[model samples]
Target: MTSKNRDLRHLHEFDAERLITLGRAVIETETAAIAALAPRIDAEFARACRFLLNCQGRTVVLGMGKSGHIGGKIAATLASTGTPAFFVHPGEASHGDLGMITPDDVVLALSNSGETDEIVALLPVIKRLGVPLIAMTGKPRSTLAQAADVSLDISVDKEACPLGLAPTSSTTATLAMGDAVAIALLEAREFSAEDFALSHPGGTLGRRLLLHVSNIMHTGDEMPVVTETTTLREALLEMTRKGLGTTAVVDADNRVAGVFTDGDLRRTLDAGIDVRSAPIAEVMTRQCKTTRAEALAVEALSLMEDHKINALLVVDDQQKLIGVLNMHDLLRSGVV
Candidate 1:
């Protein structure tokens, strides 16, 4: 083939090569940016964390376009991890959303050039509220950076875009920096999962970390109960009906006096105990490990782990069986 013909015919290959080059360049740039962040962890970062930590009101995150997308994610991460935060579109902030900001709140603004007009336009109003401004910007000398109480530099050497127009490396660096700030603040505050559940009770983490034994345990009439005078056959029927693999034996007062499990049944049978003639109390476990209904699932996990058991009888203060929890429940709920 002729030289011009070869060039035109192989254009697709050239384009593919160019795309690979850009992708690698972006990855390498972001890797260098994240690495450089180690040296940039200074007192300003500490000040930012302290500012956000001491903030009595919400954290309002602001940015435009690509930065706005990243800002939204940062806000979500902050809100989930213990910081009370939400994202506000810079454009909307000027029109009416500015009311969301309070004097006690803090602003985390993101901008690659540090001169996004929409975000910059809200700076004065944020200042008027006496709220602290923490800026994440690539240009440290830009107006937003200069006005910030703490400036995080997220500069990148070049964009992966051949024309240097698309926000590739700079946005990546900015996102990493935002996460760094949020996580540092989170750890410094010693935020607990219980605290996090307060912010995200509707999600899976909330269900795992926040849901207690009481919330999901089989309670009331669903509980498997057998009196001390109940026959072994009667106790077995109750266990089968409850589908909990165990039964709680009660006294005249309906207190949980003992527990009988399939394991105990096996041992009793191995000892040649006549189930037809014997009472259920003959094979029941007196003083069984019981948990309060309100106990956290995580606490239940600890209990199961320490006892090497798969189930627990949940009881109230009076030792009346109120509910039951098993390993399967914890596993399904992701508490274990």
Candidate 2:
């Protein structure tokens, strides 16, 4: 790096307070702009929602420059939240992607000035196609807004940039408005967590909601288990064999009677008990929290967290041990 650039970097690092103050100012400004949108969310906002809800096809979002970037994100959020939507660049639309729009589709066009040339140019074709148009713009009287069937104002007081050129507050407001519309539609459709999980099968949300205890639990021979009649030494051996740091103590009926962990072994050692001969039942924790195989893995994580325990026994309806799971298992499964 040049000497001047290095000096500037050092100055920036040393002036932490100034950096924080500037950051706070930008956040506060954007926050106020978003707050201003609430009162304006009147009949127009409701109409936009109705247009989307009544749409038989998809919600096609169009924009130019920074608005296009925000439009893409809005489309993705809407799609994931149960509203069928996709982003189509205005420039691309004129080049032939306009065929993506159907008469049943609802077109949501975004332009801060409401006079984006590409979007404005396609107004006649969109109208001719008989598709419903919803315009989100800073200027309600601009050409695109004038051509729209319904216009929702996305105006902001000022840009966070001192030059008033960068799209800071405007983009934040637009994104927030997109979220508001998506959530409203989501609630209207009574979308569930499972529905969201289906849309995000590879994400953390899917793992938490769709994965069950049975999907990640160690079963059959992998279970570290011993009978009530077994010695502490024998239970310790089982724990070592399974490498789970704990063992379930079952009764003659094969029902989980208690759990013996390394912690219990520590206490046994502190008491100077004869582990080789002492029955595990005497030292095992009888009030163990167990889960069903069908229970969500996130629920199992919550149980472990609430009880400050690291492992649990999976049981059937008859309270017979079916499987075993530990914090390590949960971590490996991305459920922790």
Candidate with best TM-score:
2
Q: In model 2, where do residues sit more than 4 Å from their true spots?
A: 1-24
Q: Cα RMSDs of all predictions?
A: 4.2, 3.0
- Candidate 1 lDDT by residue in tens digits, 199-304: 8778777877788998778887888888999999899999999998988899999888899988899999999999887898888999688899888888888998
Name the top lDDT candidate: 2
TM-score of each: 0.80, 0.91
lDDT of 2 by residue, 1-336 (tens): 999999998887867788889999999999999999999789999999999999999999999999999999999999999999999999999999999998899999999999889999999999899999998899989998899989988899999997999999998988889989999999999999999999999999999999999999999999999999998888999999999999998999999999998888898899999989999989999999999999999999999999999999999999999999999989999976
Q: Residue 199 deviation, candidate 1, in Å?
A: 1.0
User: Each model's C-alpha lDDT?
Assistant: 0.87, 0.94
